[model samples]
Target: MAYTKHIPKKRILCRELQFVLVLLLGWLAPHSLCAQRVSIGLYDTCSIQLLRVCPLSAGYKLLLNGKFVEVEKGTELNFSSRGRMLICERAGNEYEPCEHIALVHTDPNAQFELSLLRPQAETRTYDGNLSLFVDFGRIMCLNLVDQEAYIAGVALAEVGAKAKPELYKAQALLIRTYLMGNRAKHLEEGFNLCDQVHCQAYKGSASKYPYIRQATQQTAGMVVVDAEGNLITSVFHANCGGQTASARDVWMTETPYLQSVKDPYCRRSRGANWKKTVSLNDWKRFLQSKGVSTERINNTGYLYRSETREGMYELPGGIAVPFRDLREYFNLKSAWFNVAVDGGEVLLSGRGYGHGIGMCQEGAIRMAEEGKTAAEIINFYFRGARIVKQQ
Candidate 1:
């Protein structure tokens, strides 16, 4: 009785304090619940070999079409398409046509590593769980990862890892916007997006770059949208010479947000200037192939650039050719180029690295270096577009 004298009956917890504690705990919960995992098609080929796939966390389970398959950590797997089926070396298995293998683990935040063994001499590491399957008689690997994590990787891959913090942030926003704008682009192909430039050029995880992660985290769920709250196209390119192109100029589609603008910042950046010399006869022949009359064109005369149009060139004999076509035919670096005759060759002096439509990446980098934030850069490049956070 004496030992328990000082122990008062446990005081009833205050309801206000209990409510406050619950609210604080709710606020402190991880923000990852708001993030989405993107299913990206990777290595679209007939066959692929993963050199070594090891779960970074314990309790990883492999399943094929909801059926568990026996596999251990650090197992090498080869996947080949066999008449719409995937052939795997694990468990001496011959999967049915179009079978999908799912990788899961006990930990909700578990991640795994996939190492490519063939076709690419260099080894690239990829994060997130791997889903191997065959689609339309081809082997496809889908990487299911957090959307913000995907943006970090795509930004570093499309640009580089050594960009300024502000530039990285800008790129992160652009990437995120692009993904949201085209989230269902490849639904027919069984994945949300492709790993190539056709979608967003996502090579692998950018976890090594702290700045990329920071940029992506800071701009989480942010997307460029028009005034009506629709996601903007969010296009970008390597450089734009001195003037960015309008969507109407490049792709013949007039979009309100993709208006042309002068950009002096990219003129001094990398990929600003390029030179390619093709034989004047070859040039004429190529134009003639496009139904243009090259009879009046000579090897030593000036080829007139379009006066009204931004990237169109007026050839002799009334042939108006878009530089986009020429760029593709001659493998030129960009559409912002001028043609001149020099030593029996057509000297194509180009002043950009890409289509010059949408955000000029070099210009944006320069702006970021000069203390422009992601919102400022987005506003400067994308007319009538505003940054909006998705729910």
Candidate 2:
């Protein structure tokens, strides 16, 4: 999978980074924003999706009917479910739910196998304990792991495994901030976060990347906070073209820390420039569908975008439309693009990727290559944001 192109549109980005915390006793609690254990939703319906579970360490055990059964390294347990009961088949015999099957790891540093057995599946390995159960008549895999381990997995999954140590450290801090800020998002769902793009794309484990693991460990329990000591929304993207956009420009609600900034580090990076073309008439029709009247407007000039607004394109009758909306409608890379009239088609020359908010991954990589520290890279992108350790 292309990790750099994991930028979902602005709406999705907003949902991922939104923070709603109250200044009450709940906020002061230790487990409110900082917890060592994270329950990651690995699979929603394990029966439909092929799954294989194995033991990577010597002391791994399967909890069945309140009994701890040692799971061998070579034993492969195939999972299946019916109604509310979960079944585990090994060799040929089928074992019933026994309420729930909990894979326990005795050693904290030892890893285990939580492999996806389907065709073309990324066979991911994981550390920590796993509990397999039937939720809403579907088999669900929940991973109970350490916070730092989860951050390492997320950093490698979002930014790839080969990033520099500084870049990895930067990503690890942002992901830690995001995790703490959105820790209770799925409280009612029996997990802290899901292993999907909607919850920051955690692909099971971090055993494959030692550098990312080290970075997460080095920044353990550290999170970015605003001037008021409140946890800030931690949003990042693949590349920000030449400049980053403000939260108000993308999500309509202004976050003071997410203000627009001039970014030169990612201008020449990968996924920086792109062009998309559509017939002029078709483009005009699309605008007309958005309640715009293009009959009297000149059809030979670049689209008029608002100076105050970052990605709003101004049309005739003073009608303004967000580039985000257009990008979604036309499947474009980003909302930051320039519209021009060609002989037969309207060409959209675009820059950057994702919502162009928070830290730019490509820029962070370049900054790391230039010997900038993780804290420096983070402070450069998020205005007035400081890294702090959770108490």
Candidate 3:
């Protein structure tokens, strides 16, 4: 993984010095160095055919097939794809066929609103320029946005606007760390990342919450690094059910900083506990499918319990079933659960909401509410990790 690269301290200091000199010489903007621009694919999971773009900033220029067309602010323009060609139209204007189209804003603080018309999705406002092209029988929409703006959007989407500024700052650092590690995830697709949970759920600019942007800016060019001075995998979940899972148990990969930790902060928060029931026969059949003997199909054989997060569910005759496999097969919320055989039905009492690995969002929120700093919250969850400025 890119996060595991061990950069030498001498080289890092040299780069920081060079960056400072560049900033002093007026060769680079302050925000340009810390919060670089990134290209993100919008609505990547949806097959978009038609889109409506409205500029929210001044000095907007429309580029149609490499030619610049003057466009005023707040002008609504519609674009659609037809047989591998891009079609554009203004209100009450004829549809013009073009190979590609881009909406560029000369203003540094550019913003735009995009509405997915063909799919009839919700309209979202973004802080960036917009580019459109036809690809694979649909219109590919890309947003050229600042990294800090993108991080703010992701922080709001992931943790919501009601969280403390400390939580937002902690989340921003993790989001930025993940971005730095996985920037080339979709390089072949012509974008740095997609606006989805597969990369990070980005609903657009975080304009509503000024504090979100402030927190993101405060943590600009900062990321969590392990003892070896390499970026750490900053994974997080909704909750940890009072105990976070280790990376070795969840992903079968040993990570020194991602070990299991006791987290009591989120126990009373939402997504902490859940329950589900299934037929005893179904449970037995699932175990049988996993190669458990028929003799071990008794009522006691199907019973299991997990006081703490365990990697496997031990059955009779020394047979074991991975909790992750059970969670996937039964669609359970998390792998931390207790299995009890009640008559012909099996009740699964589960805890947590996600994979139960890494930092817990609700736990962090509670910590932040308790006046914990962003660094304290991060270090609490990710043990032995240091928050440092990116070189």
Candidate 4:
């Protein structure tokens, strides 16, 4: 412009288009980097009729029915359900019943405590906001929390507080990956996920464990993905005996990254080996229920030995029973076990403490103690999986 240069109309239009594109991208960048939020169903499995909530932070904006009210810090609010409405009482002031109640803290780092009064459940502290409503004649409590905070809490609940930072990081990655993959699991139930083992155990905030929060932050925005960039299932168990199981062997679904791997680290851990003895008659009856003939059961075909993990327990007449079915029937610790008839009881010697799929927590903890990085621990359990930042 200073040199008074002449420009063609098409050239000027192209430049303007480029500028607009740059502006558009810039505007979208912050949104892309925004932290994800999740609404978790707290005490999801309990029929909570009464709940008590108190703000641990400065204050919260209470949305009752359709009106907004400012609640000061440390104000304890009691909520009870009346058919389809939620009744909230603070101190001695009883407000009008609300169909919906939401506690929104203006501070991004707010904390709150929730306790079930009617059914009598342990009190739990959580980060972010709380939402409450009535459904199916019970009070439904939902925690709207930042995704990373939820992951940290889940990791703590899953792995406990005595893990190394690397182990915590590995668990955090898997938890986040699972959340991203299964976000819609409870969409019909009016929450993103439930605080139960069926989804992931989330007791509360991981504030007690400083290392857990640090590990979660270090691995923020990360998730495990397959070669095709799809999120891996990210399944884990307490222990795997001496080896992990394949998804095909356990769940009947073939997953490339979930292939079995010999794990040397978890053998000496607490959950490695266990033994349980059930009545032999009970075992035989269970096998009979699964179509094992009396002839096969009496011929000792039901007495099986598994030096390595097996998907099926074969009987004399070419009939096979799934190990998972046996595990469930017997309340066994794991499917990887040796079955033998000892006296009047069926002696079941089992290895591992869980389903033996994906990462083994004991093994990962050992790896972390041996200075393995979180990425290394994940790669060792999940073959050929990649840990990539979440989009």
Residue lDDT tens for model 4, 1-391: 0001122111112343334323422212323556567778888768889989999888687887557898888899999988888999999888998877889875546999998999999889999988877777878787888788899999888888888999999998999889878876665566677888778888999987788898888998889999999999988998999988888987899999999999999999999999999997787888889878865357366588877888888888788889888887777888899888878888889999888889999999999999999999999999999999877
**C-alpha lDDT score of every prediction, in listed order:** 0.69, 0.74, 0.82, 0.82
Model 1 ranges with Cα > 4 A deviation: 1-34, 45-51, 69-98, 106-109, 298-301, 304-309, 316-318
Question: What is the clash tally of candidate 1?
Answer: 0
Q: What CA root-mean-square deviation does each model show from the true structure?
A: 15.4, 6.2, 7.6, 13.1
- TM-score to true structure, per model: 0.82, 0.87, 0.90, 0.89
lDDT (0-100) at residue 42 of candidate 4?
A: 88
Q: Against the true structure, candidate 3 has what lDDT?
A: 0.82
lDDT winner, 1 or 3: 3
Clash number for every model? 0, 0, 0, 0
Alpha-carbon lDDT of model 4: 0.82
Worst 10 residues of 3 by lDDT: 2-11
Alpha-carbon runs more than 4 Å astray in model 2:
1-35, 43-47, 118-120, 301-309
User: If both were scored by TM-score, which would come out higher, candidate 2 or candidate 3?
Assistant: 3
Off by over 4 Å in 3: 1-35
